[model samples]
Target chain A: MADQKEEVKLLGIWASPFSRRIEMALKLKGIPYDYVEEILEHKSPLLLALNPIHKKVPVLVHNGKTVVESQVILEYIDETWKHNPILPQDPYERSKARFFAKLVDEQIIGVGFGAMAKADEKGREVLAEQTRELLMYLEKELVGKDFFGGKSVGFLDLVAGSMIPFCLERGWEGLGLEVVTEEKFPEYMRWVKNLEKVEFVKDCIPPREKHVEHMNYMVERIRSS
Target chain B: MADQKEEVKLLGIWASPFSRRIEMALKLKGIPYDYVEEILEHKSPLLLALNPIHKKVPVLVHNGKTVVESQVILEYIDETWKHNPILPQDPYERSKARFFAKLVDEQIIGVGFGAMAKADEKGREVLAEQTRELLMYLEKELVGKDFFGGKSVGFLDLVAGSMIPFCLERGWEGLGLEVVTEEKFPEYMRWVKNLEKVEFVKDCIPPREKHVEHMNYMVERIRSS
Candidate 1:
C-alpha cells in the first residue's frame, strides 16, 4: 500500500534446494518477479544488505522488504497472493501441513542428508536403516491421501521436496538407497509422479542432469573436505 | 461447526520450554482448554495417537484434529483466536517477526543451548564468543525498541523467552554460565524484566526453584550420560 509499484525479487543460486523452494512457491502463485542469482561463495551486496542475519538465499525481496528462510518466504507468498493456497484454511489442518514441512527440515530427512554425506561404510548402513524407517513413517501417513495436501501439491510436499530433491534426483540412487519406489512405497511413488506432472513444479525445478551433476559435486566436496 | 462442542486440548511435559510456549499462547489468547500432562519417557496413549509422527509435547488438539510443533501451534492459536495477536498484521512485518522467531529457534540460541549443555572449556570459550557476537547483533536490532516485538510482548519475544527461560531462572547461573546478564546484555535484561511482568508469561512459566531443580538434575543426567 505504501509503495505505488510493488516489486517481488528473489535472491538465490541455482541448485540450492532452499532457494528452489521459494521459486516453486512464486511459480505456483503465478507471481512475476526479478531473480538475482547470487554466487554463494561471493555473497552479493544486496543479499548481505537484505538478510544480514542469515545472509542466505532464497530471500524474497517484496516491495523492498526482505523475507528470509525458504519456509518463511513460502508463508509470506501464500499470505500475499491468496490464490491457489499453499496451507489449508482450518487452523488444525494448517498445523498438520506445517508439521510435515517442518518435519522435513528439522529431523525427518535432514539427519539422513548429513549422515549420508559423512558416514563411513558401517555408519552409512546404520543411516540407511534409519532413513528407511523415517520414510516408512512418512509413507504410513500417505496411506489414503493422493497428496500430503490431498488432491493437490501442498505446503508439506514443497517442504519435503526442498529437503531431498537433489537426493531424489540421483544422490539416493547413486548411494543405492531406495525411498519412494513403487514396490516399497506405492503412495509415495504416486505422489512423486503427481508432483512431476504439476506445471509449476516442472518450471521451477532445475533439470535432472544439471541438478545431479551439481549435487554430486557437492557431495564429493563435502565428503572430501 | 460440525462438532457443536469443539474441545481444545494440549499434550505437554512440565518444565519443557516448547510446552510452555503453547501454554503462553493459550493464556495470551484467553482460550480455555484441557491440559494433558505427559510423561516424556513414557508418552500417553492420547499423545501417541494424536501426534504419531513426532510424539513430542505441545500438541494442540482442536475438534479432534492435531497440531504439533510449538511454532506451528503458536500460529494456529493466533489464527483461531483473533484477540491478542502473536504476529504482526502486515505481511512484511509478519515476515520480520517470523524471522526473529525462526532465528531464535534455529541458530542464534540453538548454538548457545548446545554449547552450554556439552561444550568443554575450550569449546565453551569459543561458544561464549559466538554467543556474545550474536547477542550484540540482536542488541543492534533493539537499539530503539523496548522488546523484539517493539512495545508489547510478541512472537519473537515468546520465542526468545522459550529459549533462555531455563537460563532466566538461575539454572545457567548455577552452572556458572551467564546468558541474560544485566552487565553483558543490558537491553536484553530490560526485555526479560518486561516479559516477566506480563501476566500471561508469569502464569505459565515454571517457578524458579522448581525449574532450577529440574534443570540441575537434567544437566547432571546429560553430563553422566
Candidate 2:
C-alpha cells in the first residue's frame, strides 16, 4: 500500500484509451488516485502546466511529480508500485513486452487513428489495409498465448487491450469496416475475448454506447473537415 | 559478466545512430560481442530471420535470443549485465530520463529526418521551424543538469548523445542550415561537448567524413526523387 499521505491524481479525458491505459494500470495495482477529466476542446490550465511539452491528457501526478506519455506512465506505475506486477521480472521477457507495447502504439493505435481520420473512402481503405497488415504481427505474437501478457494481463495487454479491443472496436465502426475479425485475426480476437472477461478490464472500459457516440461525434467532425 | 559461453552478436549498419545507440550501451556495460555490419539496402538473411517484424538493424543476438528496438535493447543490456548502469535506479528519475529520451527521438531524430527529406525549400523551412520549436523543450530540460542523466553519460545521454550531436551534427550541413546551436541550445550544446570528450561515445560515433558521404548520398537520392 502507498503511504496514506501520498497524493495521486490523473488528468485525462474520459473517452481517451490513453487515459484508460493509466486508469487500468492504477486500478490493477489498486493505487488510489483522484481522477480529473479534462475537456479536450478546452484543456485545463493544470493539464497544460503539467504536460507543456505535449499538452495532452493522461498525465499522472504522484506526489506532485508529473509523468506524461502513456507508455512512460505505465512504466512509472509499474516501478512505483510493487504489487500486481505489470511488467515481467526477467530482463529478456521485459524487452519482449516493451517491443510489443511499442508495436501496438505505433502500428495499431497510430495507424488505427489514421485509418479513422481519413475523410475519403480511398484514404480510409488504404490505411485500413495497412492497419490489417499490422494486425497480423500482433496476431502472430498471440499464437499460443492466452493474453499478450500470457496467463493474466501484463504491460502489453494493458497497452494493446486498452486500444485494440476498446478504442478500435468503436473506431472500426466509424470507418464502416470491421478491422479486426476472428476470420482474419483469430488469436487477436481470442485475446480480446479473454480481456472482456476480466472484471477490472471491463470496469475501466468506457460504456460502449457513450464511447460509440463520442467516437462517432469525432468521426463526423473529421469527415466534415 | 555475461557467461563466457554465451554468443553475443550485433547486426547493425555503421552509419546508423540507432545501431550506435546499441553499440554504446554494450560498450558501456563492458560486454564483449561480435559486430556484423549489415547492408541496409540488402539486409542479411540472418537479420531478416532474427527481426522479421521490422527487418531492421541493431538487432542484438545474445545466445540465440534476438532483441530489436534500440531503447528496448538498451534496457535489456542494462538489466542483463547489471554493471555500469545506464538507466537510473530510481523509478521517478528514470521516468524523467525516459521522457527526455523520447523527446529526442521524436522531435530531433524523427522530425530532423522529415526536415532533411523535404526536397523543396519551403517544405524544409516549415519542418525546420517545427524542429526548432521542439528543441526548446530539450533546452528547458537541460536547465540544471549536466547530462540528461546528470553528471555521467547515462541512458538519456546514450540516446540523445548518439543521435543529436553525432547524426545531426553533419546532417545540418547537408541542408546548409544548423538545427541546433550554442546560442539557441546552450545547455544541449554543452551536453554535446561533454559527450564529445567521453572516449566511449567518440568510439561509437562513425567517422564524420563517412557519415557525411553516406548522408549526402541518401539526401541526393531523396532530392532527385
Candidate 3:
C-alpha cells in the first residue's frame, strides 16, 4: 500500500551484515526499493551527504529522508509498514527483541571481530571463550522458541541472522575457532538451522566461500596491524 | 491511563545518568512508578536477578516484565503510555530522534568518560577534541529547533538531558575541560538552557555539588588506575 510518491532506496554493500539486515527487512515487509551498492573504500558523494555523521550504509532513503543505523532503520520499517511486522506488537517483547539485537551487534558481532583479530591462538582462545559465554545467554534465550522473535523470523532474527554467514561461519572459520559448536549452543544452533529454512533469509546472506575469503583477508590485515 | 494491574518499578542509582533517564521518562509520561534506589557498588540480589544480562541499573519492571537499557526503556515508556509521547509521531522524525539519542550515548556520554579518564591533560585534550567534534554534530542538529525533539522535550532530549549534569557539567568540571562552552556550541548550549527550565528535567538531575564530587572521585580512580 505504498503511495505513488513513496520512493524507497537503499545504499548498501552486499557483504555487510548491517546492510543485509536492511535488505531482509525491506524484502520481508514486501517493500519495493532500489539498491545502490556502495564501495565502502571509496564512498559515493550521495552516501556522504545522506549519512554525513556515520558516512556508512545501509542508508535507507525513504522519500528522500535518510535513515541510518540498522536497528533504528528496522524499527522505522516496522512502524512505516503495517504488513509482515518485524518487531513484536507488545512493548515488553519488542524491548527484549531490541535488547537481543543489540547484544548480537555489540557482544557477538562486535567481539567476534576481536576473536578474529587475535594475533595468536592463545589470544584467540580467550576471546572465543568470551564469545561462547555470550552465546550461552542467547542459547538460554532460545529455549522453547524457534527464533528470537518467536514462531516466525522477525527483527532480532534478521539482525542475528544477517551475522550468521559473516560472523558465525566465516568469522569462526577465518579465525580458526569453533566458538558456536552445537554441543555448547545446541538451541542456538537449532535457531540457526531454523533461520536457514527461510528463503528470504537465505537470499540476504552472502556466499560462504566469498565471505570467508573476505573475512580471512580482513582478519589477516587486523592481525598484522 | 495506566491499568490497575500495571505495576512499574525502577532499579536505579542517584548518580547514574542511565538510571536518571528512565526516571525522567516515567515522570514525563506522568506514569507513577516505584523508584528502588540501587547501591551499584553492592548491587542487590533483585537488581542482579532483574537485569542478569548487564546486572545494571535503570531496569524497568512493568507488570513483572523487565526492560533494561535506558534507550530501550524510554521507547517502552513511550509505547506503554501513549499520552505525552516521548518520541515523535512520524516514523522518519522518530528515526532521527533515535539516531541522535544513540549518538549522544555512544559519542558524548561514552567518549566523555574517556575524556575524563585521561591521566594527562594532553590525552584529555585529544579526547576532548573528539567529544567537541561529536557535540558539534548535535549543535548543528539543534539549529532552528528548541530541542532535539523539536518544540518540546522528547526522546533525544531525555537521552541527552539525562547526561547534562553527569557528562557535561560534572564530567567536564572533573576533567578540567570545557568542551561544550556556550560560545563554542551556541545552539547546544541553548538546548541545555531550555532543558534546565523544565521542572521535571531539573528534578531528575542530581545535586550539582554532590555530583561533581562523585564525578571527580571517579575521574581520579580512572586516572590513577
Supply fnat for every model shown. 0.91, 0.88, 0.97
What TM-score goes with each of the models? Answer: 0.91, 0.95, 0.96
Between the candidate structures 1 and 3, which one is better when assessed by lDDT? Answer: 3
TM-score ranking, high to low: 3, 2, 1
Give candidate 1's error at residue B46 in angstroms.
3.3
Winning model by TM-score: 3
Candidate 3, residue B159: the lDDT equals: 86
Better of 1 and 3 by TM-score: 3
DockQ scores for all predicted structures: 0.82, 0.88, 0.91
- Candidate 2: list runs displaced more than 4 Å: A119-123, B120-123
Q: Choose 1 or 2, whichever is better by lDDT.
A: 2
Ranking by DockQ: 3, 2, 1
Q: Is the docking of candidate 1 incorrect, acceptable, medium or high quality?
A: high
| Model 2 accuracy (lDDT, Cα) | 0.86
- Residue-level lDDT of model 3, residues B1-225, one tens digit each, is 777668989999999989888888888887888899988679999999988888988889998898998898898888888999999999989998999888888777767888888878898889888888888887888899998888888998888878854446687886568877878988987888899898788888899888888989888787788
Real contacts retained, model 3: 0.97
lDDT of each: 0.76, 0.86, 0.85
- Which 10 consecutive positions of candidate 1 chain B have the poorest summed lDDT? B165-174
Question: If both were scored by DockQ, which would come out higher, candidate 1 or candidate 3?
Answer: 3
What are the chain B TM-scores of all models?
A: 0.90, 0.94, 0.96
Per-residue alpha-carbon lDDT of candidate 2 for residues A1-225, written as tens digits (9 for 90 to 100): 778888999999888889998999888898888999899899999998999889998999999899999999999999988999999899889999999898888777777878888877888888888899988888998899998787889999999888887888697775577677778888988898898898888888989888888988887787677
Model 3: runs farther than 4 Å from truth? none
